[model samples]
Target: MRARDVRAILFCAVTTLILLIGSYVLLQSALISLALAAGWLAWLLTRPRMQRVIRRLRGEPDWNGYFRND
Candidate 1:
């Protein structure tokens, strides 16, 4: 696999592990976990690259090609 792919996988795995640890630290409260997850989602949604990906997923065309057509 490509180095970029490997880095992405590692980032995801580490993020998940950190979230799990955060929940554990919060005494496994479902409400807290949900809030944390929602916060993360909100943060990601605000990112330019992520916005382009979301738009692409919804089949909306981006004029600037923020996300490469390739």
Candidate 2:
């Protein structure tokens, strides 16, 4: 398998393991699982690198663009 594919599989396995363990050891309620999933998603969304890549892709004007606009 390719390196990227291997990495992806490993990541997925680890994530699944973590979620399973958390659910089993902490609380078995559906609400708790849903909350954990939502919290994980929110943490991923607020990451700094993700924000930078998203802003660049959206073509938001930066410092250089601001100076040119003046």
Q: Which candidate gets the maximum TM-score versus the true structure?
A: 1
Candidate 2 residue lDDT tens string, 1-70: 2354355446545775588568857886767776776776567547654454445557764544421322
Residue 42 in candidate 2 has what lDDT? 65
| Model 1 lDDT per residue over 1-70, tens place | 3354355446545775688578868777867776776676667567675555556657877798543536
Give candidate 1 regions above 4 Å deviation.
1-22
Cα lDDT, all candidates: 0.63, 0.58
- Given candidate 1, what's the lDDT at residue 15? 72
TM-score of 2: 0.42
